[model samples]
Target chain A: MSVKNLEELNPIQIDVLREIGNIGSGNAATSLSGMLSNTIDIGVPVVKTLEYEEVVDFLGGPENVVIGLLIRLSGDIKGMMMYILQSSFANVVLNTFYGKQLDDILNVDEMDKSAISEIGNIMAGSYVNAIAGLTGLTIDISPPSFCVDMVGAILSVPAIEFAQVGDRVIFIDDNFKISNDEIKSNMILIPEMESLSLLFNKLGVEI
Target chain B: MSKVINVGIADLNVALAPDILATYALGSCVGICLFDKTKSIGGLAHIMLPLSTEAANPSENKRRYADTGIAELLALMKSKGANIQAVVAKIAGGAQMFATNSSVFNIGERNVNAVKKVLESYKIPIIAEQTGENYGRTVFFDSSTGLMQVKSASKNIIVV
Candidate 1:
């Protein structure tokens, strides 16, 4: 399917998109805060369209990259959600869960199955719910699968890449500050090409 | 005296003496072991990706991505008086954790391909490898005898 250029989107469509990101991110933050019982500080979500290379650059470096994927099916909306976290920030989240400091050493197996799942469940569930609320739709969410490592490995899927290329992607960039350290997370929203048109129509916003 | 060193994703630790080079829970990431038979020195690196060129600031962080970590591990071996050319390599890890109809994010496959390509380019012959499946793996390499073992859901401590 041909992808519509962002420039082709009307102002109302852009506003709707931004509002969706803000609501979804905010809801995710709230859910995480309650789950961890800590005052989770999430920066105001910013929406943007970026290339694959640009997303990698925004991740800063390898040391801090933790990728997680969640699939959600909300009524007529079925999509995959992905998030990236820096290593140091990941440690903080881990520490919060354990209620103590984790050894500087990370156990990849344990973290992937345990910490990553819990976090993904909280964030993805909340985010999907927010979207459903805004669109007056019900969405079913699948369990989150964690991928720790490079983005290339995690995003090598042809369909995922195609959807990304065929849509006006929205990125929610935010930082989590815990114990004097700043960690960044990017929430990538890639609506299916058809879904975007449907969403715009539903919102009464012309593309 | 021999000592064992274990590396994990996002973290790398070293043990200078002849011992086991171990890493657990390798999924979609490569575990690289470098052994110097003469010095009985060994190092293991669990690298997640092929390169750090995309990272904003690539440095000596051994636990982040693959390219930079491999270089750093080799340099560390060189500094310890281990002959680079004499070092033998055995690698493991890189498992697909999820099943997707669309091969969009088959990270396990990509990781294995990247590791093999990089090692070949570096002229490091991988004498043994255990990779690519839906299960997780735990790898152990003994520098003293150059014996690498892998433990997974399907297999138990099989020598590589």
Candidate 2:
């Protein structure tokens, strides 16, 4: 059965999407808080259909954007999640952890790798788990591998089938307020549209 | 009095007196700095990709890739009256950056391998190197002293 188009998705379906985002993001925030020993506050995650160009703009004036893509089997659905973070934002997060004022606008290599990797691990694991629960599926995430320097180059890779149908994209606006510094991270979830329908059927949601 | 030159990613600068060469911000990219202690001459090349053969335009863009870069760097040093055999090398950068399930895309690992092989072909020993993992790096070489300093996630400064 062909899934209803985005325009045809009812209010309940929209609410379902928003609630799923909230649950997934909440799990991520909780995990990060436990790891850092610092109370982390997260805004309610929002779901919307956006054009590719709009998504780029929402991410800010993209200069050196890094996108991390992971595909996992969750129950009956094959979930494809994309995590995007601006290089500047990554530096801000690092500086917050250092608790030092950045005097130079230089390279970010000065920060420790363990710290950054831990951040990626926690955030991706928690967010994926939340999505799995909402869809009533079990998912095993691949270790987070990253590409840096150019967003355009990463996105151009043919291996990542991001444009495929049955893809539901959820963009997350993550803000970390620590030591009076605000750090932002973006998370995007793109579920294969066909798999999504199968997932909804498993959830007993009336199409 | 000798000169030194320091190079950064995508950009190169020269220091003539007590010549020193350096490069920073190498991830899955290689940094090759050549030092001629006797002539007090040095040169640094910070390359991003692996081969210039894949470039849309291939006309000796040293900052774009590694293979073509090493050749260009060697020629540049030779032009400066620095003998290739007398130059000692220190290399840094080429970090994993991201953890992936497949080792095939580990550009950091690839970069280190390519650099070592090229330098070996030239019979230049890598006197010092700091690479691998998911962090960034900053490298400084003082031509006057023939000293290379590497700073990264770790606090200790690696001097070569």
Candidate 3:
């Protein structure tokens, strides 16, 4: 069977998808709180079904230099999960991990890089587990890779894959909020179109 | 201000001298720019996949694939009175934004290789290239001088 575009999903189906995204982000927020040893809250998850080009603008613009971490998932369901912290918030995360003031510049060292990788791994791991638990599907994630790049470049990871079928893509926008700090982080999940259907079917959401 | 033309993903366009052709946030996609020095006309394509045959079904946007997009770019330039034989290529983007252990996410490398192969087949010499790194680049092609300005946060403006 051919894949269905995100536009084809009904409003009810979209709500169901948004709830799933909420659960995933809830799990990820827990992990972040534990990692930083401080309370972290997540804002309402924004779910959008957009074309590839619009997705590029979701993180402000294609040229916004942001710190991004990516993980590819397989097994019962396949997709790509990403964690993004703008350079400003990334410094806050680093300072929290290091327990000291880092330079004003965003200079991430080896340890800092690994911390970012860990962030990706933990967030994606929890998100996939949330889906797996909800739908009773087995899921496996690949090793995490971290890089500092423009939002456009990071998003292109999933964009290239989805392009094979069509221009449509499912975007799960999760915003991270840390207590007492002006910090912002974004977690975007792009699920494969086929796997998305399987998820919706298992959850009994009418499409 | 020089007029700048925007190129979309899987879409190709051409412009004349003193006009700039630009594409944004090229991560895995290759921006292929071909310019005729004498006529001062150039074209650019933001290609996603490496080959059309690799797609399960034929994509409606032929410019989405490397092989077809390059050919279309040449054809577009030719229609505008640009000499195809005199056109030289300068390219940017084709970066592995993330390091995935699995080969499925290695589309960036495949895209770079496919773009090079396509150019080679067309007998177009590549004058300069900035590809296969872990950074996203926005490239602007100046048809006036055939110089491509590659901009990224991590580096200086790469001119080719």
lDDT by residue (A78-178, candidate 3, tens digit) is 87776777776767778788765556324677788887778778878877888898999999997777778778877787778766545666566766767
RMSD of each: 10.7, 10.6, 2.3
TM-scores for every candidate against the unseen true structure? 0.55, 0.50, 0.91
**lDDT for position B48 in model 3:** 88
- lDDT (Cα, tens digit) per residue for candidate 2, span B1-160: 5433546443444344455565544555567777777777777777665565645555344555567678777787788778788888888767765556778867667767877877888888888887776655667777677677876533467787
| Candidate 2: tens digits of C-alpha lDDT, residues A126-185 | 766775776657667655555453332232221123322422355667766644556677
Residue A36's C-alpha lDDT in candidate 2? 59
Error of 1 at B129 (Å): 10
Where in model 3 is the C-alpha error above 4 Å? A1-3, A100-106, B101-105
Model 1 regions more than 4 Å off: A1-11, A61-65, A72-74, A100-106, A158-164, A178-181, B1-160
Q: Give the clash count for model 1.
A: 11
lDDT of 1 by residue, A1-207 (tens): 322644366666767877887787788777777766777677777777765435545665222235456454545665666766556656777677775454432345564447757777777776677767777766677776665544433433322234324323567787665546666677776665566676666666666
Model 1 Cα lDDT, one tens digit per residue, B1-160: 6555656554554455556677755656678888877787777887766566754545355455667777788888888788878877888767675666767567667767766777777788888888887656677777777788877543456896
Candidate 2, residue A149: how far the Cα is off, in Å:
2.4
